[model samples]
Target: MAQGDMRDRPRHAGAGDRQMTALDPRAMRLANAETVLRALYGADALSQAAIATATGLSRRTVELILVDLEAEGWVRVRSTEPHASGRGRPARQYAFRSEVGVVLGIDIAHDRSTVAAADLRGRTLHTAVVPMPGEPERAERLAGTRRAVAEALRAVGVRPGQVGSVSVATPGNVNDKGAVDVELSMHGWTGVRLAEEFAPDFAVPVHVENNAKLAVLAELWEGATPGADHLLWLMLEGQYNGMGIVMDGVPYRGVDGAAGEIFWAKGLGLDALTASPLIGLGRLEPEERRAEATAILERAERGDPAALSEVDSFADVLARGLSALSWVFAPRYVVLGGWLAWALGDLLATRVAARMARNAPPFVAVRRSTLGPDAVVRGAIRAALDRYEWTAARPLAPERRPSPVDGG
Candidate 1:
């Protein structure tokens, strides 16, 4: 492992570990050791007997594996308490070490950016939001993002060297190479290489992803659409507007990372209908367009004639677009996100379902995003943790298995 850099190295693989081939008996032993570590991860510690019962292994086998893992610094012996009988040796307790390092998640909006730090276990340690210069250059946005991340790391008592990985959510087409090849929200941000800028600052692996796509990923991971393997996230209102498609529980960013740029395809003559209702609301306040849009929807929900007409027209166009996309993707769930979704959730949901239900498939369920505005950031954090896992414990692959002995 590289010194002070956990980005590309395993957390517990030491120099003393013998290289074990697939045929080596040590391979299975390593696998069993991983099982024990997983059992301990859910709880503070586990007794040898408990681990053996949980792993379906004998007490002696559990003891041997713990001995090896303890030597490897992956597990620590907490205590050896004697049984109440007093004649027998104390039961051995072991715990998985979770404080090896931290990860960072950065979410960039058109006018603002947020930074968060979390441990490998996905527990948030610190978070901060900082304003970005309006319509700034790419370098200026990067500088602001870096400053916010530094503040978060410092608040969490972590240094750049301690961050195992960093994930950034931006409004753009993030290609497979992890670069923001096309950023719509950040001016002069095309071809923003995430690793090139962040590697020098944090010395950790960096991931740049589409904000809408990350929100969908977050929803699938641990949000409203859990187990909704096929999903279409229609961000109803956002500063950086777009859609995010997910197939089989994974984001679909297209061949050129522009799969969900459907927002650009204006249709159904929605501009004249959805636009005029909120004409006077902004009153020279160009920034209040989104908020005014939300207010129009709210009034429509209350059966106001003008507002209702405008909102129904918007929903008509929205359903038309959704119908076309549904014919192509056939998602199981449609997650309505962004501030508009938050402001007028059930109202807009009911309206859209009523309109699009006939054209779309029957299995597709539409719902509002429960994580609200934090969805993208949460997904970015999960992505960062996944990066850490790739380096820290990919071989063990604990998440692939369920613990035999479980403790909350």
Candidate 2:
């Protein structure tokens, strides 16, 4: 193992671990295997001697666990150059077999459905996007999302059985049961159990989360907001405006998962703020709205006064919202994400930051997202990977075995 990997390799036994070790010998073996497996997963590769030293286990114990994990397809021996010593060969190094299974991350927005397939290491293998019909029925929207997931999995050449977990990021308030509690974007989306909808197809654990919250998670996972334990994500997607709150490095899904639903209230002036040509183009046909919005943004970029005025007005609305949320959350950073961020770029973010300077804390900075439009899906992948990591402590059941259509 590298020096960097060895820095935090020691495992501290907690009360649960102390209790577990008091169990039968079989339980002891399981515990030892889990410890070795966790150490291997955290590093690029570890020789048996390195694993033994890092895990505080006997060399023989580490070797036995490695053999078992390898047989179970959860570990792989890495290929290394021969040692410089003329006396013997180099010690064998083992790596976590992250490519052994796949995971799915689906993002279902009102206008489009995107699905990304990733490995256990959270590398996106393939992605598929399908445009939704305007004002689509609930069933139609769900079917489209399902088709997108299927296409993504097929492109990755992995079957549903090969997936360890599936996570969905949707535009709504999601409850603990993975059901939409409040449907903000699409009609008839409330009360829909997304986990149940996809469970039969995937035959694995399915999780659902609000897209805004997931966007915030993506920012922490892959976005530019590094080391920001307290952060806010202002979502400005089509026909939807919301806030995602994160405090102490965890998404704060308030009571009933409605923490950041301030926009829907009439008192906030957010609805009227959407009337500007740069923000709200609801009067135009759905097909024309996006194009017109793009043109208006282009005009603003070219320094058109009218377009700039509209952008400024839109920024005012965002600034007010950010100012209010900042007072409450006092976040270290605020990220502008969703379609609006992608379209407006830093121009809008800078304006919002300038407008909020008087009201918000000086330390609370605002910036545009670098994760692009797929942030929600990428966050879903992170969520699924988090869920997958928990399963590592247990043995893989026979039914959960992955059989790839081509290869991982």
lDDT of each: 0.69, 0.77
**Model 2 per-residue lDDT tens digits across residues 335-359:** 8887777778888989999988888
Once fitted onto the true fold, the runs of candidate 1 whose alpha carbons sit more than 4 angstroms away are 1-20, 23-35, 38-61, 67-99, 264-285, 288-291, 294-298, 390-408
Instruction: Report the C-alpha lDDT of model 1 over 1-408, residue by residue, as the tens digit.
Output: 112222212233233343542356765576666567656665667898888887687888888888877775567778778898998778777876655456778898777789977665666777788887558887888888888987886676666765777899887787887787776556888888876678788666688888888888777767787756688887655333578888876778779677887656666333342354433232122656756765876677778998877756656766777877787898988877876567667766777888777878887777878887788888898778656742234222233211211110
TM-score of 1: 0.78
Query: What overall lDDT, based on C-alpha atoms, would model 1 receive against the true structure?
Result: 0.69
Q: Rate residue 202 of model 1 by lDDT.
A: 66
Whole-model lDDT, model 2: 0.77
- Candidate 2 lDDT for residue 245: 85
Among residues 3 or more apart in sequence or in different chains, the pairs in candidate 1 whose N, CA or C atoms overlap within 3 Å are 81-90, 82-90
Give per-model TM-scores: 0.78, 0.86
- All predictions: root-mean-square deviation over Cα? 7.8, 4.2
